[model samples]
Target: MSRKYKFRSQDDLYFISTATINWIDVFTRSLYKDIVVESLRFCQREKDLDIYAWCLMTNHLHMIIGTRGRKMEHTLRDMKQFTAKRILEALAEHPEESRHDWMLWMMERAGRRMPGNDIYQFWQHDNHPIAVFTPTVLLQKLHYIHQNPVVAGFVERPEDWLYSSAKNYYSSDLPLLDVLLIE
Candidate 1:
């Protein structure tokens, strides 16, 4: 995955997608979901990020966000690292998660196999942040993020995806981050 090698710029509205290492479905449990939400909430409160839209699938996440104070890459990096550690900790402390040992083994194997990464490599190193350079691209990413659940047959409409901002985008009542919605 050789990139063309462009430096990351400030205030880049990124539609980022990072998959779980080996595509492990680590987010199939509620505990994992809660930790992710908590991480996002904490970052939003403390990191000065503008979260536009987002979706949490079984093994990956799609987010549209930008930094207001810090660098976008730094903000995203912190969020990913924090979530990985917290999720792993929660999994280790909970004795009720059915795939505890299996999950731990997979994460450990991934950590060893992942080159130049920490011991708990839950997410791929590449953030895959596509800078939203055009209005059309931004809209397309928004639609794609919102439509992911429907495309995966999880729901009939984008608004039906509870983990996504589609509900907030459509209804405006869901407790979501302040979005940079284009008219």
Candidate 2:
């Protein structure tokens, strides 16, 4: 892992990008997306996470976050672990899922490839955390995060994306996740 992506400062906000193992599009289902949302809510309430911005896509997520009581890395680790287990369970419960078998096999293969993984691996290992040191960089990352859904053709407007904080920035409509406004 490069030091550039490592958690080095507790006070600075970090822009983090984490993806599903193999970019398997696991978040295409509402059930799986809800699991990630609930885990993030738990982390925010219990893990001292201050989310400034966030976007949850079909296979990955991007966020700008600051931590108060716990290290940023530790909080993210717990979130990922919890969500992985929950999402795997969701996959099992939803046999109607068209991609169920293929998705499970892909995750299982990913787990076998990694010595540290148990029977499955849901998320890719690295968060690619980049410390946001300047207003210019922070703004840049925020724009990129919001623009993801639009660029991906999932939404016509950034604020129209329900899974992102773009609405918080661009509209009066409340976003699915509460976020601290950047100033």
Give the top-scoring candidate (lDDT): 2
- Compute the lDDT of residue 16 as modeled in candidate 1: 85
lDDT of 2 at 126: 91
All candidates: TM-score: 0.87, 0.93
Residue pair clashes in candidate 1:
none
Residue-by-residue lDDT tens digits, candidate 1, 10-78: 657888887888888988887788888888888888988778889999999999887777877777789
**Could you tell me which residue pairs clash in candidate 2?**
none
What's the lDDT for all of these models? 0.81, 0.89
lDDT of 2 at 18: 98
| Per-prediction CA RMSD (Å) | 3.6, 3.2
